[model samples]
Target: MSAPSDAKHPPPLEHAASWYAASANAAPARPALSADVSCDVCVVGAGFTGLSSALHLAEKGLDVVVLEAARVGYGASGRNGGQIVNSYSRDMDVIEDKYGAETARALGDMAFEGNRIIRERIASYDIECDLRERNLFAACNARQLQGLKAHQALWRRYGHDQLELLEGKAYRREIGSDRYTGALVDHSGGHLHPLNLVLGEAAAFESLGGKIFEHSPVVSLVHGQTVTVKTADGRVHADRVVMAGNAYMSGVMPALEGKSMPCGTQIIATEPLGEDLARTLLPNDIAVEDCNYLLDYYRLTRDNRLIYGGGVNYGNAGPANIEAVIRPKMLKTFPQLKDVRVDYAWSGNFLMTLNRLPQFGVINDNVYYAQGYSGHGVTCTHLAGRLISEVMTGRDERFDAFAGLPHLPFPGGRLLRVPLSAMGAWYYETRDKLGI
Candidate 1:
């Protein structure tokens, strides 16, 4: 494997060549914005957050237009591990300790709401993204296993009672490996084809009269009573604007630049393991993530390919060879797959914040934004959309709960933030190895 480097960033205006993209449901090319358009709301970025917000707003009878830098699900929303992990990057216990019980209670109440929203969309719109149930959190050591126990209790306190604990080798029934000391299973947590999910949502949005312009990257935002979102070839004027660009919104909004950083992660899919061999790797067909700060996550795709991913590349740099970086991690988890050939390897970026919580608030009162999911975008992005839509519709209580949480910039600023975060990750990784 090549040493990590900071010189690379994902090319704009296209989806990375990934297994998700290859197997994705057929999606038509949406025309780029070629002329000025007016709408009640113009959403920047057509990933999960943008599409979810657009669909919700359209359901509320608002005219919405969405602009995308590339195709739908082109960013992390399309290429993530695809596990529907519940809650935020930093869990509720951290929010409670740092923020307060009231703030935590409000945030916790809606932690799993995103999963429900996804299911509703899939059922209501007939989105076929290979929806499956159950997500397992594996603990590589006893210390991490204790963390899972505490996590289970914490979720139970939030009225989430769908957890089941497996001690010692009991988790092997679900994970099919000896690397884990224990695991906590969430019956409601799940996985699906992320790209197809976003594409399906985009279609559902269009079905509700919402318009999307792919390949239309926002160049500037002029905010006022009426907001103007400008692209190179076209512009959009709307009563309000939603900046759901997340990691890919670079250079569009100066105000949000230093608030978060983009970090990349690698994923690889092994050639079809076949149903029998796939079952040997993940016995219960459930998605799994370990408890380390920089954790590994894997699952069996609908077609029986083993989708494995781990390792972080701060500063959004693509590794020299994604397969080289991740193949070892996968083999470490399931050494029996030593001979399996990898069919796909790719990387994607998610926005990260200093405090590991999502950043939510408005810019100049009318321009709204939700980003900095900090590696937990799968569920949180959908929640962000609901909160953004609710606030736009005049209900602000839930959204305020998140916006009230302070998001500090990295201590070292842009020049040093990447290395600083990488050092922190290394420290945590060491502790994980030592079972501290």
Candidate 2:
């Protein structure tokens, strides 16, 4: 139940205490890297990006080694809302408007590819992460409902047609809450147990002759033709390096230091409500997220527990009491859960960029990294891994589309970035309240 002492450079540890941790399948501790190793590619962090990249590269007959700061799926990859939401944090319309139609077309083509990869990996590897179908985007006000309409239209323009609009009492067919004015159901989007998925992917990667050293936090990278990735106990000399560490990484690549900031979100799981009540709460048993600037997302766990999560801390700082911060929000949506007991509460961090899109680029022609997934790491991270692998294998067209996008350092640097971003969030949140 111990928290990570250093958020940026978390020490080697077990998974955070949460519902996921309690129900996680058995996984033995991986050995720490104690001897110098050499490989075709050395990936940092065993979360989604690293595992996905390692698995893809391993399948391509390359020798891949993954080093984890903690256990597999230990970061946001393991702890997110588990919804397979598509698209980047900044959707395609914004990309097209800001970067141009060519960039938008390139990204739109792969908007849903990440979730597709998730399902494919699950079926191909027989991963049991409680995969489910359909996800709903709920709207609390007329403005947000109209926004959902535009969102559906925007997604359709990108060729994703598995959507249906629901309004009035129809919302109850999906979510029991009366808070939503309408909802958009994405038949293609879904949810699953995140930790199990990544763990299974890691096992699948190892099956392909990939090696992962847990408790091996990379302390520094000596970049050259052959990158030397140094950890506390060992070093990995490789032809290429994948810095897939995301938010938990710091001080390794100074060039990447100020471009993104880590932010925390909290989640709480209520005691099992049993099948009937659980079904009543989420009649269709799909994940649902509100359409707010700072949104709330929840889903019924396989065990029937309501897992609700929301709220953000821009500075990567977590609330002193997670349940205290989130319980009221849960009650505001589902007051019927007045007497329900919270069985678990936990917090996790995700890297955020100024533009809200993921930052993908290579360092020194060999050190490739894809981070700053903002709040959309679940699907994007998987896609990033595939793209990183593809680019390394000489297929850079799709990779360049993402890498070509611009990412800038936060305007106020580390010290003021948190407060500045907080102010922006507050402004948007106020607009949400005013139903703008």
Candidate 3:
């Protein structure tokens, strides 16, 4: 009824949806799991990765079933800044350094393919998700602009030559903001109504007769020749199980707990400004992100509201005053919007591996798990799902290329890792401020 209901009460994920949710044209919720069920495959966590995996496996005619703790898109998939930027948060050279040149090339291909999958799915499903294909990487100053220039070479070397440099008159004409000294027009990356896309894919999976169980959280996992997933209401005994629980994963897989840590990122959406004013504030309607490591990303919705996202906390508890803490940051970038009121603010945790690389691997052979998207989950999840299904079906080369990358646990362990990581963040924040 009110603007902030989705964030203030933070409706139970299964019952609540975000702005994207309000616009979704999806089928009603899948029935809850009521009793023990058997299938050829059981995928845990029904976000984009889980749903995508289920879709591919089902298309192969495998009797696959998906189990979700909350409603679909309850995690980062629904709550992200929605910018589908092309590069992995981790460096491509890291893959080359740890794996090999070919492996790095393959990884780049996967990231590119991930973007393709999003576009192909939208076209095939005829789903309406307010999709857009424009992005701006706004640089705060000359120093940041240099980084973008170097990145341009890296992207070019990988055969991605779509980005354009924007500065001065050109930059202001594009974004209508003087906060950025330069900007990168990200043709390869863009934004979308994330939850709608996730739900739409979930519907596509079911249209093919794949089963989905919502409000059914996986409590424990048994991995082996035959994988078993135990949920609160039922257990799915299957030939294979996939752990797509990106950030909210807990006892379901102890081995993965320390492989990455979750950091809370919060977002607020402004009340719908009329289209005319919204256009004036952001002439291009392109998704905008700054050059800072801890950055602010904002964009306009189809209905003409400002969806602003930034601010991070390693702890699960949100900022003491999310609205108060985040609003100032928004103003620093767009001081002209001092009178703009925040309509809603909600937060979610995103997993970050030590190297900022995504963690994808098998636990006990048949029980596969992939997490640690490091804020690139929107597109990477699609690729993760496709690779998981390929491996399950005996196509190992592509999957193993990614699985071979080493993922070490956080040094201090989960109990102490949060604060340890927070302190590390403080050191970086201090550097970003002093222009180190």
Candidate 4:
């Protein structure tokens, strides 16, 4: 199948105009690729996966170079919900059911590793990204509450004990909203300023002697004993190549085209709600995501703005007005915010695999890739980076565990995958509405 058209997936030159961009810390723009270069490893994409992989590899004293099509964190890494959600989009129990006990055990051990890595990076590197330490999975009804209870138990079996179940008035104490029937709090899972965190990681990688080049999109890649990656004006010949570009990869490699579909999700940031109101909206300042299949995830920014996100476009065409798409959902969670003004609105895409599990493997024994985090990327991407680094360094057990998981292409291939996904999502949304 042909790759998605350039008109539909244009090259990104800068960060999206969002609250994160406005509050981003200043950094010098590194020059793009102007001459041929050779490195021990060539990484494509500068988001969480690429930066983390580069940092790990550089710390091991390997020569590494990262090429970004746009600015650092230019893709979903900078435009995500910022929630440090632990584990895969599909729960561990589901993984165990489908893949068996041993597979689930291996994945479960690394489930919370990403969260730990994030915290370690923040403290060790002094990344000031407004890190918080609480995330709540809110249930819309009693049935969903039961699911959360089962979820807590399942996670506990996996050695995750930092969880608390709350209901009735107790739930209101954590979240001031009455829309949720109950909540499962995971103290280990939290939120952060995603863009700043990624930028800080990039800086850390550079400090470890890594090289990064922005506006150096990979035009073509030839895999062999030594992979060659070409751009408009320059090329990279490396012992290994890592494709970390998720949805924004834009068909740089035809092999990954049908493996995942680019789906757009949007977020809106409300104007400062004042300290008193902000505290009332989120009493403990915990991040939240509902139990619905097509869920809403939100959290309060350090500056007291409500960063609410929801709604997905499987067709990859973003809504004309992001505010219009997200504002109502925000108001539904907090009707008192009817008069609050929206300060920023933006959309970004995430690569969605048919099974909603991340895909990791090596191609031609020299080119490696990790993508399709589904919607749980904030944490999983970090885990992916660590795993990829391990594989590159010859410690391949953990990486092989994940790489062995089966990933199927979306039904109907590239042409009809989007509409098929939309139809499936609509069916689940209906089930969510009926509380089925």
lDDT of 4 at 127: 91
Q: After superposition, which runs of candidate 1 have C-alpha atoms over 4 Å from their true positions? A: 1-12
Best by the lDDT measure: 2
Could you tell me every candidate's TM-score relative to the true structure?
0.97, 0.97, 0.94, 0.97
For candidate 3, the lDDT comes to 0.80
Worst ten in a row by lDDT for model 3:
2-11
lDDT of 4 by residue, 307-394 (tens): 9999789957999988988999998999999999999999999999888999999999989899999898999999988898899988
Residue 223 of model 4 has an lDDT of 76
Q: Show the colliding residue pairs in model 1.
A: none
Residues 1-436, candidate 3: write the lDDT tens digits: 6312332223234533356656666658666677988999898888888988998888898998998877888888877888777768876766778778998898877767788888888898886778898788888878888888887777788888998997655788767666777888978788898888888898889889888888677777766678778865578999888888888778767767778888898888888888887887788788998888788889999889888888678857778667787788888877777898888777788888887888888866678888898887888888888998899898988888778888888878878888898888888777767666
Per residue, candidate 2 scores C-alpha lDDT tens digits across 81-197 of: 999999989998999999999999999999999999999999999999999998999998999999889999999999999999997768898888888889999999999999999
The Cα local distance difference test for each model comes to 0.91, 0.92, 0.80, 0.91
- Which residues of candidate 2, in runs, are more than 4 Å off? 1-11
Which pairs of residues clash in candidate 4, taking residues 3 or more apart in a chain or in different chains?
Answer: none
Candidate 1's error at 392, in angstroms? Answer: 1.1
